[model samples]
Each structure stands twice: as C-alpha cells, then as structure tokens.
Target: MDTTPIAAGTGHAEAAAGGGVRVGALVPLSRPGWVEAGRQLLAGLELGVGDVNRGGGISGRPLELVVRDTAADPAKAAAAVEELAGTGVAAVVGEYHSVVARAAAAQADALGVPFLCSSAVLDALTDEPTEWVARIAPAQSRGWRIFADFLLGAGHRRIAVAAEPSVYWAAGARILREHLAPRGGTLVELDARALGPAALCDELVAQRATALLLLVGTPEPAVPIVTSVRHDPRLADVLIGAPAGQPEFAEWASLLGGDGAAIPFLRYLPEHLSPLGARVEAALRERLDEAASFVAFEGYDTIAVLAEALRAHHGTRTKAADFWPHVTAEGTRGTISFSRQPALTAWQWTWPPIQVADRDPANPTRFRVLHTG
Candidate 1:
C-alpha cells in the first residue's frame, strides 16, 4: 500500500485522486509486549482497511494505515499518538495493553484526535470522559465479574490469585475481589513478583484454594506458575485460571503443552457470530494461519466503527470523534455502536459478548467454551 500523507483539516471532497485517507494504527510488535496479540490485532485492522477500500473507501479514495509500534509502553504509546496527530491522520486506532491504551487515550483526548481502542479492558482508561475517545473491548470490571460468576457456579469458593505488581493486574485482582466478596467467596493474593512459581504453588496449597487465577505476564510468572502447580501433587485438584485471556493465544499452548489446558479465561466472543463476523473470522484465520482470538475481531470492529464515522460526513477528517455518537457498524461479534455509558466519559460499545473458556485437555489447540455472560 502507498504511504499517503494527509494534511490536517483536509476533507475527502477537497482531495484529488491518488491520495489515501490515512488512519494511524498503534500496535506493539516488539519485545516486552505481547507480540502474538499485537500481530493478531494488526491482522484484523489490516483486513478491515482492505474491506473498507473495496467497498468504496472514504470519499472514493483508498484507506491507508500509518503504523506505529507502541511496545506496550505507556510513554511510548503517548509519543506515538503525538507523532500520529502531527502526521495528520484522520483517526488513531489499535492497542492491546491496557496501561499503554490508557496513555494513548489520554494523549489522543488532549490533542482532540479520534481514537478507537481495539483492546485493553482497563475500566479507568481515562482520568475523565472525553468525546475524543471510544473503546470496542469490554471493560475489565465487567469481564472479570463474569469470570468470578463462572468460578462460583463451578463450586470454587476459595480462589487464589498469583499477581504481578502492575496497575493492570492490580486492577483485575481488585475487580475479582470486589465481585466475589459479597457472594461468600474469598480471594487470596499471592505476590507472583516476590514468590517464585514454586513458592506460589506452596502458597496456593497452604491457603486451601480451590482455584488459582493468574494475574501476571506470560512466560514469566504465569507460565512457570502453571508448570509448578500442574506438577505438584498437592495442587492436583486445584483449577488454574486466567481471567485476562492469556491462554487465548497460541504461545501459551506452545509453552505448556497439555499443562495449559483447562486454565479458563475471559473471552469476548458470542456463542454465535453474525454473517459478517463469520466471514471476517475465516479471513482472519487465513491471514493469521491460526485460530484468531477476540482481540483480532476487535481490531476489525475498531476500523469498522471508524470507517462509518469518516463516511458519515462525506469523509471529514477534522473532529473525527464527533462521528462516534452516530456510527453504527456491523461488527464481527455483534452490532457495533458507541454510546455515553454510565461512569465513563469515553464513547463505549456498552457491551460486547463475554465468555469463560479454556483449551480442551483432550485437544490442546482447541477451545471449549464453558460459560457465557
């Protein structure tokens, strides 16, 4: 695709031929980030852009993406937003890390640039609600509560969380705790950062926890903890869980093989897909050469929403976020629409489907949906 440079305040009606309506894509493709998740997200976004162009792109010009790697750093993400804003992108989209997305959202809001967050479920995405930003992913509070409910229904009253010290992980642990407290459930926090996987397993055993939730990064504390717990005879009956959807990616199975199975996690996919969703999922699977996670679907939905916003006003680039309240696009998971939700200032999808699922122990690569919300 050609790299088309857009000037700020430019309109599709005023532009000549051969110029692309550029959208900035922020993704973490490098180390220290979840590179697999980032790749899945980019695949969906790229496909969405292709579909947009094929369907008569903004005001007849092709839609282009100006890609930037955030690398899961909040400061780096903010910097990318600044650079994209200066490059005259009509809107900025895509991010996987909650911490980084929060930073990017703040910067985009301050600069008055429209941002469509593809993933990252942090409930407090911004200090205050602004019209400049919106999100496609369900919030952490909402998703985690469903996970808690799943655990309770499965008869796990004593749950333990092996958590790393990070704002995102901390927030998830808090959400789980808050949701479980009133329901006669208990949450035990084991410091994954301080305790090694072996020691973490020991704590789980000592606590008599029926289930262990992983609230840490992959390959580090999460993977090792799963290994230790699965091998320990004392933890034989203890269920392992990842409410942040860690096991949805391929890497988890590659690392733990059969051990990664049955570690239920939160996922944002409906039991059934719309017609558009099924087609996109097939395309995404071909593009990714694997089963695509919900994040990839979010990438497509993000662009779908933004495309409608841009098309609503005959391809007006200025005040792109003004299109948020009006955009209604058919997304992979469901009908995509943004509204001012309660307790949030940013435009929210109000909901996306939520599910609790895990890899099937009988077939490590296959997922078995256990619960839905």
Candidate 2:
C-alpha cells in the first residue's frame, strides 16, 4: 500500500533523502460515502502536501500522507485514528462528514494526537473542550444561521425542511429553527423517511411553505424530492434549498440537470480568491479535471496550516501550545487561523469565509454567488 502524496515540482529526491513527516488522512473513498467529495478533498490535501515539499520539504524533511478510508463510518474513523497514532503520524487531517470527524476527533484526543479537522462543520465535535483537535470549517450553527438568513432575505418566512435522521441534520434544523424564530420566521420539519417524493410535495403544498429545504441525503430522497417538487403543479412557486451543500458536487448536476440549479447551499469561500487561493484553484481544476468544491480548499488549507505549524515547532506532532498559536498561514480562501469559540467543542477558524451559492440554471457547472457572510 503506497500511501504517499503526489509530489509536485522538483524536490522529490531531496525530500526523500531527509525521511518523511507522516500525516494521516481519513477520507471516505468508497461506497456509502460521498466519493466525489472525498476525492476532491484528497486532491487539495495532496496538493498542499506537494507544495510544502516543493517549498523545501517541511524543514528539509519529506512530508508523507498515510491514507485511510472511513467510508463515512464513524467506527472506521475511530479505528483509523488509533492505527495512525500507533504509526507515529504527527497529526491527523481530512474528513468531510461531521459524524465521522467527531469520532476521529474523540479518538485522536484520547490518544493525545493532534487533529486539524479539514471540513467537518458539526458544532460540537467533542462533548468538552480539548486542545487535541482544531478545525478549518465553520461551525454548523454559524453557517446554517447564515443560510437561514439567506432564506429570510429571499422572503421565505415559512420554511419547511424534509430532514432525515442524523445528528448533523438535526443540528442544522435546530440552528435554522433558532435563528429564524426570533427574526419573525418559522421552520417546519418534515420526516423525510416517512414521505415519498409525492407525499413530500403534497405536504409542502399543505404546509404553505414558501421554501422547502432539504436536510436529507443526496440522490435517493433529495434528488427525487427536488424532481417531484419541480414537476408538481401545486408547488411551482415553492423554492428548493439544500444548505448542507448537496449541489456542490458534479454528481448533483449530472443527476438533476436543470432541476438542480438555483438551489442555494452553504460554502466556505470568499467571492474572490487571494493570490495563493487563485493559484491553488487553477492547479486544483487541472488536478481534479473539474472545478473544485470548497471542501477541497479546506483540505489544502489544512495542510498549509499544519505544515507551517510543524515547521515553527520543529515538525513535532500533537502539541497544543506549539501548533495552536503558530497556525497563521496564507490559505487559498483567506488567512487561516484558529481560536476557541463558545459554540464549538473544537478550536474553530473563528470562521472561514461563508457564502450561499447556487448553480446557474442556464449553466449547471457554473456557480453564482447569491449571498455572502
């Protein structure tokens, strides 16, 4: 199993001569996971690792990634962290699923290993505060609140969410509910599993919801629900939304085509990229053979921050005081840094830039920024 990152530029031989700084990457690459998202995330992580090596190999030592497939399973993530800890990785990074990241974060903290979580937005990553883990993504509450605000701006005072059972979805619903209630808005929850696409549409009509938000899985219920609603005569004026970012992947457009556009979702990115962000975005497009999602940028920024922290602290792994204060790096999105937040159980980025965006109906591949926060 060659679990090495794709080396970019001309520092391979030099890097190899100085041994490698091992970082464990937990990604969901197979079935039951969002494979496309995992691939994009890995591309960014690998690109960041390559750039670090090219910039003199993390203090003259090669950086290597030990990859593990979580498959969106929390148990697998926990076990992978245990294995990675035993294998002497300086830190663990990269996970797109919030539940899986929570499991990995717990395991990493238990084993006293540092984990710079790449893209999980769950508000409470741990039950309590611990320095063993920090995150690059905004908390679910923060992002969802912004998403809820977008809905309000669009005049959706009566919103309905077809939500599946999951801590992530439940948390998002709660955030929307809380954020909306005091602002003269309301959120109505619908059981996604109990309602077929037709039933879901009927309920949307009966509830008189101005907008229908999807807090369900992609393709199965979400795609079908969108299709049903888009085709339904009674729901013609109802807006469809997916704030958890289902439409950010190419698969959504492939499956839904024109029906998938204009469905707003949350993404962590500035309207414009920094110089470093633009360069990385170009490289990522070439590397991915498609436009990269924000999750991928999170992965790349994870490595960039970790590499600088490692260099500042002599390439050591898992030291809270050492890495926490030294992680200011020029990321693809914005200057990345971490601080303790009241709402999060992990050290948060205070927030990465957040946006509410959607695919242009005329061009499914092209994203149009609808709102920024």
* Model 1 agreement with the true structure over 16-130: per-residue lDDT tens digits: 4557777898888987989999999998898888888778788776777778888899999999899988978788999999999999999998998888899988987899978
> By how many angstroms RMSD does model 2 differ from the true structure?
1.6
lDDT string, candidate 2, 227-335, tens digits:
9999999988899999989999999999999999989999999988999999999999999999999989999999999998888866777457666755788898888
Per TM-score, the best of the predicted structures is: 2
Best prediction by lDDT: 2
Query: Backbone clashes in each candidate structure, one number apiece?
Result: 1, 0
Clashes of 1: 1
Looking at candidate 2, what is the lDDT of residue 45? 94
Tell me the whole-model lDDT of each prediction, alpha carbons only: 0.87, 0.89
Where does model 2 exceed 4 Å of error?
1-17
Residue 230, candidate 2: Cα error in Å is 0.3
lDDT for predicted candidate 1 compared with the true structure? 0.87
In candidate 2, the residue pairs with backbone N, CA or C atoms under 3 Å apart (3 or more residues apart, or in different chains) clash, namely: none
| Residue 199 local lDDT, model 2 | 91
lDDT of 2 at 217: 84
